[model samples]
Target: MALQHFAGRHDGNRPLVAADTVDDLLPDLVALRRDLHAHPELAFEEKRTAGIVAAALRLLGLEVHEGLAGTGVVGTLRHGDSARTVGLRADMDALPIAEQSRLGHASRYAGVHHGCGHDGHTAMLLGAARQLARTRRFDGTVHFIFQPAEEGRGGARVMVEQGLFERFPCDAVYALHNWPDLPLGHAQTRPGAIMAAADRFDIVLRGHGGHAAQPHRTPDVLLAASQLVVQLNTIVSRRIDPGESAVLSVTRVAGGSSHNVLPAEATLTGTVRSFDAGAQDLIEAALRDAAAGVALAHGVEADVTYHRYYPATVNSEAEAQLALEAAAAAGLQASVAPRPAFTSEDFAFLLRERPGAYLWLGQGGERALHHPCYDFNDDALPHGVRWFCAVAERALPMDASSPTARR
Candidate 1:
């Protein structure tokens, strides 16, 4: 569409490319996003959402497979029913946040919305499938993965645990997330660790309680907790390697009732981010040690717990290049730059199993995913669809590349 929206709202969209055969289907993809946005579904509770996905792929003439990680849907497109294949993935879950955009397309279902733009992502891949199936442009196979529970539920890990790749299998796979900071229609990618291993920690500070004025007698857990929170900032700043990337932010602290009485216990909750498993271990050890040391130094008992969440997403160089080439062919200004993103993606589990790169698609000026006021930009559908199809056609070329050429 020449990304007419990129220029301004007043300017009309200029048709880009020959519509890729799927261009005509772009309207359907746009409509699909809006409908999903208005009627949002929660993680792992995407029964109706998943059905629509299955129906769309089926309509595209793809061999559909169901039942993975509860509601995960896989659609395989076989140009000649050959063995060679590559995969494209889209998450189907929405956040628990309420629709704050309050736009006309605001989520009709309260307490649930496609806050992360999965609606746009899912429909874009479907658009690509329609184009590929209609044109039968590629000689190899393409697998479309629609996953559930991407919002802190580990649905991707659950799907992997349930043998998603073992059962379906692919040489390489790819996925994308919408970014609010970048300009709309712009695509960027690179090699190495793009996202981090996200884990959460909860600490309970316990101590004797007494009158707030009795400073000499009470252990004052609230006072100890306050100090502990400040010290956590040092774990990533001082304990971890200077060269490695990591983050430890204390997001919530809860305890106490009245203003005068000292609370018996205080709770400290936060998240940790690291690029590698070794970094993850070091951070955990440092947290425990620091928490205990600070609490003991303050004459208070400390109860600390750590929960490892999603693993960091590491992109293989060869596969990343393949994605870039496909993106360029898709008619977008494509480039590779290591993205600095700390947000965790459950799809890291998918990349762990196969050669894959999880990409970030810019949503332009949208309020950003997870924002109560945010909305997934429907205009992004065309670029997303083209990127997925390009990845498929290039990676699984009809005329197979030489042994060295095929990574």
Candidate 2:
């Protein structure tokens, strides 16, 4: 059916896409989503998934560009004569997690799973691409970005470094993730800091090794590591401002091999998350200082290595408003997110390069994200597709003189 048939309808002040259009595409999209879920890939190893995405976009006759950032794909659709453009993105990588669900479509890969709903995200964006390509209801251009390695490998960063915006040149970009916490059909976002920055730290304490029962023979590296964990935990509570939010967790500790032997070295590894740059800087510095102090007191040398992975995901004011408007136009309940999530997103890289917003589409389920049993809620697919299509059409509307009326 032509999307123009229901383009005249409006719910309050927001223009609505016809429900039948998305409904017609839902079954095929669901099947595609499940297929992706069963055959999950990780990080840059998304060859199979990328091929599927490219073929689908080609089937729609989009200008497809592949081999970007190793396994990324960009599908360009242009209509009318306007120069305005918008980007809609979806991540295509899965996690190194084993599937625990007994569902028929559970991951066939033993050690990889779509525990984070990227499969759903990809399917939704593909659905939007198909719908938009079919209707050509908007002016200017829409770039469908199928990114890889979002699960800690930094596909977005690589894409940017390799000239993502330089090639596509979107005036604005938008992406959405299926949020299991919020009820289905609801959406939320904020003007800034939708997700926290992720940083990882590894520390090793070196000293003398000796028998466990020996006195004054060893520097007690394990004991120093334990103390260091306590000190690191206090960095957020005491060093960072109480008004701000930050998390410093010591997730791993390793040292001695034998029960009666004191190891010469102990290692500590963990992650830090924060929204503010000031907080991130202060925490890193304070952590280094605390590690040094502990090591000196224990008569050991401290070695520290820290890596900043992903920056905090911040949404632009105008684009954020556009996302909420698009959500409402899609007939979904929308609101400003009460607080930013502590989890980090690589989409932050894209937002840093362009004006855009990252949105959370609620998909209530029994399990939270990253859980072994977690699966993308197929019921939420139509909501995501509608929002994506609405955002594109709203961002690049056709002028009255154009053959197609504004949807």
Candidate 3:
């Protein structure tokens, strides 16, 4: 469908775009979202999604730029000669999980799904882009950023590295994710560290392989790996400060293929989440120490590799307040988030470059993010669209002498 069909008529006297304005665009937005849901794309492979986004932006007469970070798209809208610019970002990637939903629009692909609601995020941002383009309610430039590879492929970081801000400079940027925990129409955010830093660790224990029946013939690499896992779990409790919050989970382990033989090697892989750099360092150090200790006790050689994937998502105080205010202005229930999520986001990389806030738009559902059964709540689309529009308007209000104001 042409995006122009979703545009609402602007009344000069209406100070802000009403919820009903977004409501009028809901059907098209929902269809677009479901289309995206059905054709789920992963990481930097969002060609189809990027094409759709670029086409919609072009239909709205926005300057469209694509191919940044391979499959990222940015649609720029400017008005009233204002130099100020604000970026509204939406991730355009799907998870690698199979869709369990039986909905008519469930993913057509076998092992991919929009389990995290990026489809809704992209649709809402597009809906806002359409509304803002039609209404010209804001004075400054608005860049609708459709980023790829947000699902652990580091799309945001890649965009920044490719000079995302340099080509389309934004004074401030904002992003949102749908939260299944909060009731629909509620929004939440805090000033600092809204999401934790994510780090990955992979450990390999190598020793001599021998018959399982021979008790003393081998170093028992699997035994050392098991012991390492136990000690790694204790790092947070015994090493990290009790006052701080962190999580260490052993998500995967691999060893022997048969019960009759002791494997020469065993490996452990997991993630570390924390909000503080000091704590991250301490945990990494303690993890290596524990692995070394366990390997020594079992007469195995331990090899440890730890990598920090994404930094903690910290929000600037002013931008965070503006985000909450935008939520309230959009007629949603806005409040400070009670606690930061342990989940990590690549948008953290964007925030590191520019002043911005990442928000959670409530979509209340039984299934949480990344769940196979989860789908983006169509009911929350209007709420999110309104919030995006309101944030753009609030960030770059029209001046008395502006063309939009005169109209």
Q: Which ranking of candidates, highest TM-score first? A: 3, 2, 1
Q: Candidate 3 on 1-407: residue-level lDDT in tens? A: 55556543433323344334676778889989999999999999999999999988887778999999999999998877778899999999999999999999999999999999999999999998888876777778999999999988899999999999999999899999999999998999999999999999999999979999995989899888888888999999999999999999999999998989999999999999999999999999999999988988999999999999999999999889889998998899999998999999999999999999999999998999999999999999988888998888877878745432311
Error of 1 at 165 (Å): 1.1
What local distance difference test score does each model get?
0.80, 0.90, 0.90
Poorest 10 consecutive residues by lDDT, candidate 3? 10-19
Give model 3's clash tally: 0
For each predicted model, how many residue pairs clash, with residues at least 3 apart or on different chains?
2, 0, 0
lDDT of 1 by residue, 1-407 (tens): 22222111211112233336555666656767888888788888898888888877665556788778888899987766557778899988888887767588789997998888988888787777766765555666788989999989988888789987777788888998887877886777778788888999999988878898887888878878888888888888887889888999999999999988998899999999889788899989988998899788878889989999888888888888877777777777777765658888887888888888877776798486688888888777888988897888777766665442364
State, as a TM-score between 0 and 1, how close model 3 is to the true structure. Answer: 0.94
Question: Which residue pairs in candidate 3 have backbone atoms (N, alpha carbon, C) closer than 3 angstroms, thus clashing?
Answer: none
Answer with 1 or 2, whichever has the higher lDDT. Answer: 2
- What is the alpha-carbon lDDT for the whole of candidate 2? 0.90
Cα deviation of 388 in candidate 1 (Å)?
A: 0.6
TM-score for each model? 0.91, 0.93, 0.94
Candidates sorted on lDDT, descending: 2, 3, 1
Least accurate 10 contiguous residues by lDDT in model 1: 5-14
In candidate 2, which residue ranges exceed 4 Å CA deviation?
A: 1-20, 400-407
